[model samples]
Target: MGGPNLEVFKFGFYIMFPIGIMYYFGTNLDSKFSVDGFWPSKEQSNKIPTEPEDIRAELERLRRRRLERRATRLAEETRSQQDMAGDGA
Candidate 1:
């Protein structure tokens, strides 16, 4: 290949190669900064609910919520029926 300025290109690579290698590894030379963010500082133990009374209370609350939702749906359905009857006139 009879390319002009080939010596300049060769010199540029020689100069930049060491800088690139340093940038790739020098800043992370410290072991502390090289790790990911998942290092734990606190207890990670799984906590299961320990009280039967708490479970019973939660169940009662959920049952109340379900009954309220059913009542609201039934009320809205009845209101839609009245609206349809009025529209048919």
Candidate 2:
């Protein structure tokens, strides 16, 4: 006795979704809808490549560079400590 009208709820989705879609597409008539700075054209979709592999490669390269710099800094720190220890002896 305290619920929504069944007749009004019936076919609500069939009408609501289509109307919502129409309004959405209507509002975005002349602009590009993009996600994550990557918007692919229908024809260009075949050529741009997937995000996962590219992200993996880019992350690997960045990790390698970061590790290399860390190693270099560590080596320099070790060399300075050794020189200090030798001078003290």
Candidate 3:
């Protein structure tokens, strides 16, 4: 049978080994002195207007322009084909 001394040593080593390693490597004192403080007084502009209704209106205008251009191109293609057919017949 193992003695009580061996059991105590095993428990102490299991608990203290990780805490000792963490204490030794975790605290970096030199890097704490070299940090620059943040500038807290910078002026920033609110350039973007955050209106969803204005965005929706602009999107609808773009959609209408795109559909108008597509319809115009299709109508011009159809007219050219009709003119070519009439000239051949």
Q: Write candidate 1's Cα lDDT for 1-89 as tens digits.
A: 74657878888999999999888877757673666655665466544456998778877988999999999999999999999999999
Ranking of all predicted structures according to lDDT, beginning with the best and ending with the worst:
1, 3, 2
**lDDT value, candidate 3, whole model:** 0.83
Angstrom error at residue 6, model 2: 79
Q: Which of 2 and 3 is ahead in lDDT?
A: 3
The worst-scoring run of ten residues by lDDT in candidate 2 lies at 28-37
| Each prediction's TM-score versus the true structure | 0.46, 0.43, 0.44
Candidate structures ordered by TM-score, highest first: 1, 3, 2
Misplaced by over 4 Å in model 2 are: 1-50
Question: What digit string (tens of lDDT, one per residue) describes model 2 on residues 7-71?
Answer: 56766977899899889888865574645547767777754436999878877988999999999
- Cα lDDT tens digits for candidate 3, 5-88: 999999999999999988877678557544555544445533343699878887798899999999999999999999999999
Q: TM-score of predicted model 2? A: 0.43
Clashes of each: 0, 0, 0
Relative to the true structure, candidate 3 has a C-alpha RMSD (angstroms) of: 11.0
In candidate 3, stretches whose alpha carbon ends up further than 4 angstroms from where it belongs are: 1-49
* Comparison by lDDT, 1 against 2, better one: 1
Model 3 residue 4 lDDT score:
100
In candidate 1, how many Å is residue 11 off? 24
lDDT of 3 at 86: 100
